[model samples]
Structures are given as structure tokens and as C-alpha cells.
Target: NKQGRRQSTISLSTGSGEPISLSMPASGERRLAFMDLLLKHHINGGELSEEDIREEVDTFMFEGHDTTAMAMSWIIYLLGHNMEVQDRLALEVDSLFDDLHSEMRNESNSSSTTEITLDAIKQLKYLDCVVKEGLRLCPSVPLIGRSATEDMTISGHVVPAGTVIYCFIYQLHRDPEIFPDPEVFNPDRFLPENSGGRHPFAFVPFSAGPRNCIGQKFALAELKIVLARLIRHYRFVSLDQP
Candidate 1:
């Protein structure tokens, strides 16, 4: 190994002699793991301790796992019932398939996310809308609470400082004034032309403002890549009574 660094390998395979496909870093570049980054800060940056690393890792696992899994489940459900929507998305996903090999995946901005190229994921316009619509219909956290720092008036009502404001995302998403026929699983609502006029805070699946969820972009990237792969490989249909 270069610079007296020993390389190691761990294999999870049977000796059946089947070829394996995995994307790798460029010829001379080495990849860094998430923990490696944390360890680097722990040692060099001196900002993260061993305990801090452990807690951050735990938070990453806990926050990123179940909620993303649940979002995928709900998106799958929506795709199943909405065959036309799924078909359109499938066409979009398929158009990008030629550019992305079936086994194609490479690390993006974060290792704790799906490995598909960020550029490829960005090309998934319909899938992006689908995920947003899915989250709107089935947000992981149905409600969020925030405290008002200053007195303000909303809807012609007065509010005082230090007041706890509970926003019911479940109900907010279903408001017909904001989203026409909100109950319908419509991804078009997120299209740029249609969404341009919507208020920034109109959609708050991951909360909003400075105190928002730190992992919002990470979670969205993860969900999009995973869903892209799944939809490319399988066609889902609802089994429920029509």
C-alpha cells in the first residue's frame, strides 16, 4: 500500500465464481466512510469526542431509517393505486436507465445515503415530485410544534410571545385552499409552473426555518435514489378492493 498504509478487504460471498458489480472511486482516489469523517474531526478537528461520534451515529441511524422506510412504503402505496401516475414515473425512470446501469451506484455528498450518482438522481424530475407528493399525503411527522419568540398576528388574530404553536401538518396538507383536491395523490402540484405561486412555508414536511431538521436534504436524497432503483426494477399494483 502507498504511504505504508495497509489495505484490507472483507468479502460477503460464496466461492461460486459469479462476477460482482460495484462502483468505486477514481483510480488514485480513496473513498472516505462517514465514521472516518467523524473520526477525523474527533482527532484533527477536536470538535467531536468519542461519545459525540457515538451519539451522532445513533441519531443518524435512528432518524434516517424508519421514517425513510415509511416514506417509501407510502410512495409505493400511492404508486400502486395510481397506475397512471406510476406509469408516467416509470417512463421517466426508464428514460434515465440507459444512462445509469442497473448496478450503477456511486457515493454522493454523504455516504449514509443511497449510492446512486447525485447527477442521475437529479434527473429524476417525476420521481422528485412523486416523493414530495407522497410526503405531503403521508408525512413521517404528522405534526410539529414551535414556540413564538415574538408577538404576531395571523389570520387577523393576535398571538403573544412564548406561545407554543402546534402546526397540524396532516390537516395543513389537506387544505383545499392551498392544494386543490388535496386528497388526490397528485405529484403535479409540485411542478415548477404550478408550485411557483405556493408559499415557501406551504409545504413543511421537514419543517422550516433555521431550526428545521438538519438531515432534510440527506433524507430526501436517500429516499429518491432508493425509490428510483426500486421503481426501475418493479411494477407495484394495489391488491385492495376497487
Candidate 2:
């Protein structure tokens, strides 16, 4: 609602026979950053108490680190299970490293150590696809829920206001219509050409929209660096392998 005024809200039946309406005070003004909003403005009726702020900060730290770590571990597991994919990733990253080193060696100060800068990591296009595909197969946060502040229709289904919408991101990622052979670990699924005409929301590994994961870019970069370095140095073998 706006200014504490009751807005037309919907009640969602949570399968427990109880209809519940979830509401939060409408944002008055947009701030430059989330921290600015958190620190400056009063949201959801009034200013968030110190305890609320601390909880928010703690949630971010815990969720961000845990989700990224799990996603990276899942990616490593996928690579281990698929030797051909692992080999391909290694080959791609090796080529990228070779190019980067060659370019660095060409510098006048050839003694400068070659390091994986952000720009250098971005050059690994194949690795990016691999990461995206891995996320699609195994999303860290499998579910997300949002409430409808207003009445809306989705796919011809009328969703009343105040209705809680629970999205199963894991199922969405594996939707056969959106991703053919969705269960397969095929990095090519995310290739620019291959992914053309796909629904943007088909992949929600880190959720999406206004409340999407704030550290998604940082997490992806970290995952790429860790995976690239590890793959370049060692070949991972699955436990199932004799």
C-alpha cells in the first residue's frame, strides 16, 4: 500500500486452508543504492529497527556466500560427472590462458607476472556458457515466492490480488519446452546462437527481477576464476570411476 493506505490486495490459499495476505509499505522514493534505502528511508510502515538492519546484513552475508559456494560445488560435480565436458572446458580455458600469457609476454616489461584480471576472465566465453549451463542444471536456490500486490493474469489464469506465488526455479530451469534435453549437461545450450529466442526467465538460478541476487555477478566471476584455475591445473575424476 502507499502512505499506509490499504491497497487492493489478494489472499492466497496456502493449502493449509488458511488464506493469507502479505503486504509491505510501498517504497516512497528510489534511492541511489540498496544500502542507502536501508539506512535512510522508512520502509514497510516505519523505519526498520536496528535488529532488522542487522538481520538483513547477516542474511545477505550468509545467503550470498552459501549459495555461491554450493553453486560452485555443483558445477565441479557436473564437470566431474562429465569427463568430455571437463576436457572441453580445460581446452577452452587453456587456450584463453595461452592467449593472455602471449599478450603479456609481448609487453615491454615482460617480467610482469600474468594475472587473471576481470577483463581477461571475460574473454572466456565458453567458460561463461559452462557456468550458465551448470546453474541451469543445479540452481542454488531452488524456490522463490512473491506476493501479488494487485490482481494479475498469468497464462490465462486469473491470480487475485494478495495471492502468494511460489515459483519453483528448479523446475523452470528444466522445462523441456524451454530447454530441450534439459537434464543433460550441455554447455552449448547457453551458446549465443543456441540460446536465441529462449525465454529470459527460463533460467532463474539466482532468481530474477527487482529482488534478484545482488552478488550474482561477483559470484559468477569468483566461480569462473576458481573453476578455470582448478581445471587448468588438475583433471577432476568422478568417484564412480574405477
Q: Write the per-residue lDDT of candidate 1 for residues 55-140, one digit (tens) a residue.
A: 67656665778788888899999999999999999899887875454334442333242345778889888889999999999998
Q: Candidate 2 — what's its lDDT?
A: 0.79
- Give per-candidate clash totals: 0, 2
| TM-score of structure candidate 2 | 0.75
lDDT (10s digit) by residue, model 2, range 94-211: 8988877887778754755567778878988889999999899888888999999999999999999999999998888888988889889999998899999888788888788999
> What do the candidate models score in CA lDDT, each in turn?
0.79, 0.79
Clashing pairs in 1: none
Q: Which candidate is the best by TM-score?
A: 2
Worst 10 residues of 2 by lDDT: 5-14
Poorest lDDT segment (10 consecutive residues) of candidate 1: 5-14
**Superposed model 1: Cα runs more than 4 Å off:** 1-58, 99-115, 152-160
